[model samples]
Target: MTTPNVSTPRLKAPAEVASLELNPHDLSATLYNNDLAPTTRKGRTWSSYSIFTLWANDVHSLGNYAFAIGLFALGLGGWQILLALGFGAILLFALLNFSGFMGEKTGVPFPVMSRIAFGIRGAQIPALIRGAVAVAWFGIQTYLASVVLVVMVLAVAPGAAAINSNNFLGLSTLGWICFVSLWAIQLVIVSYGMEMIRKYEAFAGPVILFTMGALALWMFIQAGGSIAWSTGEAKTGADMWLSILGGGALWVSIYATFVLNFCDFTRNAISKKSVVRGNFFGIPLNMLLFGVIVVMMTGAQFKIDGTIITSPSDVVESIPNVFLLLAASTALLVLTIAVNLMANFVAPIYALTNLFPKHLNFRRAGIISGTIGLLILPWNLYNSPAVITYFLGGLGAILGPLFGIIMADYWIMRRAKVNIPDLYRTSPTGTYFFTRGVNFRAVIALAVSAVAALVLAFSPAFAHLSSFAWFIGSGLGAVIYLAIAKHGQEYKDVSGEEIAVAPTH
Candidate 1:
């Protein structure tokens, strides 16, 4: 809650100013929290390696493993699933670059970045939307990680099953214990701040990759070096193509939240090249490799046990070796904790902080996010495949338009130029303080595009096109925003040099 009055004369260069160097002192108290301020050059310490490991940790999560293997259960062939993963990874890379570039260039978080398109107060639309999604995912991931803990608990003490059998509020007593334990662990870890999180990601990412490789190899050997290819109910011709496209869309939808708030991480990146390199290696290549291993492990398990276990945690449970079980359980904990904090936890903290900058800093906002995550009863959301599918589809529909609108405004209309001080200004003369601090054009575009996308995702007639909700929503949002904004004063182009010399007003 402390607002320092330090002079920031060096903030003349938007590209060079970091969080501490930015002139938040001259801006409105409501809009200029240190947590939401631009990261200083000194603050941009994340290297390409940091980004690579970050993505590695992101890919190695229990949720992602279950997500990838679930494609096989959804009638996708192993090869088809691999294709879907690759397609999603490539598309994700491109979209991440779009968001990451803005973060790197301007050193701003996602909610603040949205200000360029959504206006000052109007930016809260996307910010709150993203915060809600992040909270849900946070709860879901905590539940997923707790599943791993439950496995470890049962392994150590069989009597825990009796406790697990007794249910309340859609979760068992044992399940609640495990969930709260993992939640507390994550809460403790993230409380140390982003520097500690970054270091942990760098270490955990490689360990996870190695552990997965070993597990896959072990599973392959256990199945006598043969792969099970005919495990799914395969589709042919047009059905097959639709499955591939839809499956890829589903994969992309899983990371839709990450794609939007990628700036939260990229703002810490040392350079744009670092972000690109990290994403290139971490996303497409890492995903393809991880997918192949997932296929190997699951396909081998099918061959060995005559049935496939979709949940990676369940797969670990079946291992008779106590040592291997403990090791795998530890890996799963590390993997989930890394991803939950980096992906689910950080975004919401920033979003909530943006909502009331003067009252909330990172740590306080993080506690609120975690509390909300627990209150949502996330276990119910992850109970069935149908629920999961519709939930993600609906989420993508809402988030897609926001992405398109922000990217369109920044890359298309603004030409990558942003006025640094203007972003924090709340005065009538401020460029972003339009129409009483709200941009109705962006708001209208979001409402129209999200509603149409939601209809496509949920309506019975358009159910077949449900998977393309994100694409359709984003495309429509961009088109609609551009059409309406072209005739307005919102599209004014401001250069970097102009931002450097622009008055705070």
Candidate 2:
């Protein structure tokens, strides 16, 4: 009797099977490292309070102080500045949640998250833009912190000012010394990784907050227990409205870099509730508290002396007690380090690693990033308040499109669903491996939107609109991306895949 031939079921291809089981923790070196991989359960330890203190430390820096007070130079009254802060804080809260939600859901860093929107290899473009901007800010913050150190030294020993007479690379000998010293201190702190950074932030934020409150109290006493909040030069009608709007734009611009890369921090949070709660308290409420303290201190300083003191270092320099000066100076030092690490250093580390995940890990990337930051000589970029304002506007223009593309892809096109395994895959079998591992839709969208924003930011005819560059760019980016992507295969490929949700406790 002829037996019926039994046919074996066709076996799935090896690559296909592997793709189905591509665990984030076991991803290839070219696509993953300990630093760039999705956070493990143990790694997701940051509480709501931890996230709150992160903002607290980041907001209370000398550079941020300069940024906030610089609005006064543009003709905003203390009350207007506070209003702007609130407005910007609301904008920041929304933008951060858009980006932070991705991290909270996926437990991945910003560069890794970009892979969903931009292909695995194409992710490098946005990463490079972010890294370069981060390096510039890192150098700028380092220089700002060093200025505080220089002020402290000059206060303690007036003879240190002699070093200023011999200038090198637009900075004094003492300036170089202080800059390098602070740089090293930050590098040492970064070497301990994110956990140490979080702990340090918890300690640093409260110290600076306390010091700022005390400083404001002392200023109130010096001003005979009253502070006059003045409207500078009396702007009314469109001019006043414009100034207020610009001031709000400046507030957002100051935090634009952090907002874009907030996933780097939020991925470590224990819950989305933690991220949202922390961000609310950290941004809107935090900005309110910080803005009031700042206005009080600066206003009181103006009352005591006819000149406006915009710099925190200047405020500390004006203090009469040597002990308090020393204490305040030390607190400001902590302030700068915390903000620099939180805002500047951490971003580029992950970004550069994303560029060469096989060759670079976090520490190596940090070293390279720090070296580039030092070489750029950021003091040149930070000359005056006008320069700072324009610089941030231009930066926001470039970065806003990225934020737009990311938000659009995730929330609109993909409907908050990310293919976790595909994010690390470079093979065409992976959904994200479109166009030989590049998503030209995202590339084109970024290019077109950023160009438009840049024109608005730099054109003399559109100078009044420059302050709105971030808003304009981000809005244009999202709209353009949505328009372009709707016809693309990536948009159609959206399916109900089982996404690996991070445990939210």
Candidate 3:
């Protein structure tokens, strides 16, 4: 990574330097520098492999495989499904590039990036929303992962089946025990902070990938070298294309939510190149390869069972070798938990901290978020299709527009320049201190775009548009914010000169 320019004035308050006409060339480096503790300088440490491994873990999970196969089976032929997967992956790649650029340029986390659009105090709005969503997902992913464990244990010890007979709120006693155990394990991993999390992802990523490959190869061989892609049901060209497009769009949007927040991790990267390279390999390549493997496995399973099988657990259970099934299932459970902890768990910890930096440190904030997830367990939100659709769709809608507004404000309005110190200030002189630390323009844009997206999600008349909600929300949010900012009144210029503050020890 390029070094931040040390010649720039050291400001006590970031707002004091907001008006300075900084060279656009230094913008990326400045953003990157901002992500680290002020005590740590650039190039002193790097995390390229750690970041790359995080993606490996994220992509190689059972949930991802299930989701991929489900998309393919969305009434589309194999070729059409492949097209959709490629299209979705490409869109995701582009989105990640945009968001990741901000992190590379400014070494700040996602919540910190929100300050540019939402204002310092107002940033809490997005932070809280994002963090809450992450927490819910964290719980769901953990629960799903634990299911594999339950299945594996019951296979080995038949007595454990009784654990599932007694139920509470739709979940069996064994389910509850597994959920709590998984939750506790995640909490323990997160308590050690990002470094430990990074290490775990790195170690678990390769193992999961190798195991998945082995399972796929074994399944294909068991099918006697005649693995047909045909599902036996034929469809017209138009119908097939539509299915592919719709399925692709949904899958893309599902993953795209995190692209906006990718800087939360990439800001710790060793170089902008590393971030870009990792994303290229991780998003498109990994997703495409994974999709193909999943489809192949699905086809093989269909031929064997004479019915569709979406879950990896079901596929494993069908395997003749009990030992192989147990080993693969165990690996999958570990893989799922690793990804869940890293992607869904750590995100909210940092975001929640950004909400109340003075009061909530990282560890406490993580616990708080995790606890909220646990509280929602009684609702059984994870199991309901309607609930899952609304929850994921609603959050996905907001994420797109919020990302658009932030990117537009930073790259277009501010020209990639940020008064780092002012980002945390509460004074009127602060650049982000617009109307009581709130940017009405951004709020209005968010509201408008979010409304549009929600309408598509819930209203049957607009149902077709639901597939592309992310693009619509983000584009409209950007346009709306830009238009408002163009006419909005300006305040005092606090740009160039540095304000005095003690260096962080």
Cα TM-score per model: 0.88, 0.88, 0.86
Model 1: colliding residue pairs: 18-39, 18-40, 19-38, 19-39, 19-40
lDDT of each: 0.82, 0.80, 0.72
Error of 1 at 422 (Å): 0.5
Q: For model 2, give the 10-residue run with minimal summed lDDT.
A: 494-503
lDDT tens digits, residue span 156-250, model 3: 98899878898787689888888889889888887776666767888887888788777778778878755657566745677777777777777
Which candidate would rank higher by TM-score, 1 or 3? 1
User: Which rank order by lDDT, best down to worst?
Assistant: 1, 2, 3
Q: Give the range where candidate 1 is weakest over 10 consecutive residues by summed lDDT.
A: 496-505
- Residue 263 error for model 2, in Å? 0.4
Q: Count the backbone clashes (under 3 Å) in each candidate.
A: 5, 0, 18
Residue 147 of model 3, lDDT score: 76
| Ordered list by TM-score, greatest first | 2, 1, 3
Winner on TM-score between 2 and 3 is: 2
Query: After superposing candidate 2, which stretches have Cα over 4 Å from the reference?
Result: 1-26, 158-172, 231-233, 380-395, 487-505
Which lDDT tens digits does candidate 2 get at residues 419-498? 67667766677877889888898999999998998898778899878788888888898898888774544443322223
